[model samples]
Target chain A: MIQVEGLTKYYGALAAIRDLTFAIDRGEVIGFLGLNGAGKSTALRVLGCVLLPTSGRVTIDGFDVVRDPHEIRKRIGFLPDTPPLYTEMTVGAYLEFVARLRGVPSGRAKARTIEVEERTATRDVHDEVIGNLSHGFKQRIGIAQALVHNPKLLILDEPTSGLDPVQIVEMRQLIKGLKGEHTILLSSHILSEISQTCDRLLVIQGGEIVGQGSEQELATQMGSGGYLEIEIGGPSQGEGRAPVEKALQAVRAVAGVLSASVIREEAHVAQIKLDAPAALCPQVVRALVAADIDVMRVGRGSAQLESIFLKLTQTGGQPS
Target chain B: MSATFLIARRELGAYLRSMIGWVIIAGVLAVDGLLFNAFALGGGDKRSSEVLSLFFYFSSGTTMIASVLIAFRLLAEERQTGTINLLYSSPIRDGEIVLGKFLSALAFLAIVTLATGFMPMLVMIHGKVSYGHVAGGYFGLLLLGSATLAIGTFGSALTRSQVLAAILSACMVVAMLVAWLLGRITERPLSEVFSNLSLHGLHFQPFQAGIVHLRDVVYYLAVTYVALFAATRVLEARRWR
Candidate 1:
């Protein structure tokens, strides 16, 4: 449903996105993973028909975003990070307006508004003034506005940003519900957030796409064992990092540990990055325990997505 | 209805719902009344035409100022709040957006301008003003307002913030208003150009005095068209940024 080739956008002297090329089939929810300033938003805006590319070509459902914006616009729905809402309007009224604006016949706007309201589960606050609603509702309303028209492609930028855990789950469920109806391109800086929600991942860095595939595909192709970072706490040791090394080396011997690097050693704790199979994760923990080098906590290695992202996207331009 | 009309209806609904629209109308009415009583009727016995002229005179100034306030929010607020995305992503043309916005503001301004009719009718009761004079003066007011609102729409399209839009529009309208002053200070060809460019002095006066000149009509319409065209270009150029 979407095709892009050599798409680039430059904000005078500086390029926001460069030579981006990707295509998404109908009914697939694709996650755009990148750190902040990754040009994810820039790419989505062009696909949404809101921004014109500096060069290159993009077509959605056979219509070029540049040459036939009118047709392309009709086929896509976009939810920018900040919900574009008229605060003074009631949620119901706003949705109705957007529904009609997107080409819903005036006669059907009422039914369409109600349909979206129920779809996003915002019926309770339908008549409430938008500004008075909480941030979560506003976000849902933003999604509703995009879907009210029932566009073929849904371009959502950081849909879960700035929401509480409960709200996040609600949004996640709502997005999942939209899976079969629209082709979705959702963006997020956090790796795990969209990982479960999307069918495939398109990892970007410095305005360039470094990797694209399913989680398993990326993990296998990225056979650098994925970076596992750990912090060790102890009184003292050789080079002040030997005990941590001994414990990590034990995990390495278990078969899945590819490599481990001590990124930092401060006080009793040390930070380490490990590349290993998921099956070997327990052995790494057991090795640290056996060596008697008190291991604080071990989560998924940072070297997986975060480290790979850093290398893939040279973090020079990423926001602090 | 046309796409333009659909957009206009939504915009008009917005005007009715927002307090700023009513404030502009109420404020203009108050100013128009005060000016009528204080200046037009306050002077000693005078010709009815003179009094009517005075009413049109003060009304023109307030009307122009009101037009700017009404038009300043047309596109700027949409861009500022990020709601312009809805319009941009729709299957609509920039021209429809501009024309829709213009029609909405014009309709609202006309209603506000016409609301002061009771005051004029009062003037007509105790005095003798020609109906042609009243109709001509109102026609002039609407045309002048159309031109100013169009210029304001262009100013609004250039910025995202409503405050900046107001300032830019004020600067543009004031420059046009004072063109006659520039005309007074310059020489031959230059002075003539300035006089012709004056949004008020040269063109509006003929309409205000019940003298309908095709040239004045053409001038206002031309200004309206050029301003709208510029506004459309600004919308298109924003995608590049």
Candidate 2:
């Protein structure tokens, strides 16, 4: 639904985003992953038709961003990093104004406003002034304005930015609920936020696309192997780190296991960090069981994605 | 509604709902009333027409000042608050945004200018006052207000700070107001040019004296058109920035 090629934008003599090339299919939730000042907002601004790119081409559906911006504007909804809200306006009036501004018919604008308010879970504050709403409610209202016209594409810059943990989770659920209806492109610096909500990621660094794929695909491409955490019950007779270390020593001998170390030890349980590909977790578990070590629980660690992100941005990691 | 009218309506509503609007209106009325009572009424036993003309004279100053204050926030405040992005990303053209904002300011200025009608009605109490004079003077006030508001709109579009917008527009209005003074010192064709371009002296005097010259009408409209066109171009240029 969206195609961008050689999208370079410059602010004065400095380039903000250089040679950004990517395509997103219709109905896909695409995450634009980058660190702060990684040119993610600049690129999104170009696509949102808010800023004219210094060079390159961007097309939404079939209309060119430069030549047919008005047409593309009618087909897309954009939320900037800070929500563009009139603080004096009530939520309902603000949504209706945006709906009409986006070309929704006067007769249907009110109904469309309510529909999006419900979708974004902002119905309770419909009559409240935007300035009085909390940051989370304001963010939801921001999303609601984008959705009020029922556009085919939603471009949200930092949708969950500055929200508390609960608000972030609620925003994630809100975005996940929007998955099938519209092609979504959202940007964020938070790894787990993007990983949990996006079907595909376009990792950008230094104004360029360094990597693009699913989580496992990125780990595979970058050879940024993941680790696993194993919890053992009682540590095999409550000895020192020896019995726990010995149990992990057996798991290290399993194929594809790179290293192992004890992360924490307690009265009844111990957590071991196994440096191995997550795909070999089953074999490692079996190896622990063969050594008569009681494995209580096992799960993949989050450090893998963090390493992949760091390598891609900090060291120019290669993409497949 | 069309995008232009919709934007104008919202902007008008904003002015009406905010305290700044009423404050400005009240200030203009108070100052105009004070000048009317002190200078126009208290001086001597002047003719009714003379009193009416003095009323329009001081009213023009307040109107121009109010125009600068009112139009300074039209576009600059949108940029200050980041609400311009909403208008930028919308399907409306840049010209529509500029025209819509100008129309709203014009509508509000009309209300403020017309609210002083009672002052002229008081002139009719003692002596015979020409209705044509009242109509012509008001017509001039609205025209002057419209032209200055358009210039202020252009100024607002050039900056993000409302203070800077007000300063820039006030400077421009002052420059135009002083053109007649400049005409007095310069020679021949230059003097003639400055006099013709004088915002209040050469252009607005006939209307102040109960004559509605078509050239003056056309001049104010031309200024309004040029200024609004410049404001629209400024908005379009911002997309590239």
Candidate 3:
């Protein structure tokens, strides 16, 4: 649905984004992960057709962004970091205006507004003034505006930014609901926020694409593989580090285990960081069960993701 | 509807529903009426044409003032609130956006300018007057308003802050208003050029006196076209910026 090559944008002497290249396929939810001021917004702005790239080229749905922006615009919906809302307008009215602005027939714009309001779950506030809406509702309405015209591609920049925790989850669910309907390219500073929602990840740093793949592909590319944290308890898992290591011997002996370490230990419980593919969690748990060790709890190591993100952004995905 | 009208309708709705729009309208009406009563009516024993001319004269000032206030927000507020993104990413031409915004502001300014029509009818109550004079004066006000609003739109396009937009618009309009003064001081062809460029002295006077000269009509229109064209170019240049 999108192709970008050597996309560079400069504000006078300073380059906002430089030599950024990536592609997104139809029906794929792509996450643009980067730290703040890492040029993610600039890259997305180029794709959104809001800003002309200083150099290079971007095409959406087979139309070049520079030469055929109006054609490309008809095929895309964009939500900037801050929702572009006329606060004085009601949700329904705002959506209708956007629908018509995006080239929906005037007769159909109202019905299409209703359709997007329902899809984004903003139907209840259809008549409510947007200025009176909560942050969560405003964000939902923002999504509704983007979806009002039913564009093939949705470019959402920080769609979940500034929302509360619950609102964040709801916004994520809203974006996830849109997965198959439109090819979504969303950006966020947090790794785990979009890690699950995105079918593929493009890690950008310093205005360049430093990494691109699925989450596991990136983890694997980072050379640490996937991390699974296992909590083991029971009398056999003794107090000392030595006993805990001994108790996890069978888990280490699993076919795909690369390394294992007891990260934390208490009287009868231990947290083990296992270096292996997360898909091997079942076999690792089975090995523990066969060894008669209590498998107290298991969770994917999110800390490793933070470290991976840090490494990717800080070292430009060099892993050192 | 076409994108131009679509944008214009929404913008006009905003003006009707928002405080700034009404505030400017009310303010212009109050100022225009005060100037009408105090100067045009207060001056001793003037002819009906003079009274009507005085009405258009003061109305022109208020119209230009209202245009600056009305047009300053056209593009600047969109950028300030980030709503320009919606327009920028839409499948619409920059000229359409500029034209739509200008039309909305013009429509609203017309409403404000025309609301003062009762003042002219007051002239008809106790005085002898030709309806053509009233009509011509109003035509001149609309043309002046259109040209000033177009200039203000260009000013708004140059900046994101409405205050900066107003300042810039006021500066440009003042420069054009004083072009006749500059004409008085310069010599020969340069002076003639300045006089011709005078937004008020050379062009608007003919309409103020009940004569719709083609030269004046064409001049106001040319200014409107040039200013609106400049505003459109500014919008087009923003993406590259």
Top TM-score prediction, candidate number: 3
Q: What are the Cα lDDT values of the candidates? A: 0.86, 0.91, 0.89
Fraction of real interface contacts that model 2 preserves: 0.63
What tens digits encode model 2's per-residue C-alpha lDDT throughout B1-241? 3899988988998898888899989999999999999998987799999999999999999999999999999999999988888888899899999999999999999999999999989998877888999999999999999999999999999999999999999999999999999999999899999998989999989988889999999999999999999999999888776
Docking quality category of candidate 2 according to DockQ thresholds? medium
- Return the top candidate by lDDT: 2
Write candidate 1's Cα lDDT for B1-241 as tens digits: 3768877888888898899989998899999999999998887897778888888888999999999999999999999889888788888898899999999999999999999888768878988888999998999899999999999999999999899999999999999999999999999999999999999999988776777899999999999999999999999999889
lDDT tens digits, residue span A130-181, model 2: 9999999999998998898898999999999999999999999999999999
TM-score ranking from best candidate downward: 3, 2, 1
On lDDT, the stronger of 2 and 3 is 2
DockQ, ranked from best to worst: 3, 2, 1
Docking class of 3: high
Model 3 interface DockQ: 0.84
Candidates' DockQ values?
0.55, 0.65, 0.84
List where candidate 3 sits over 4 angstroms from the true fold: A228-257, A262-273, A279-303
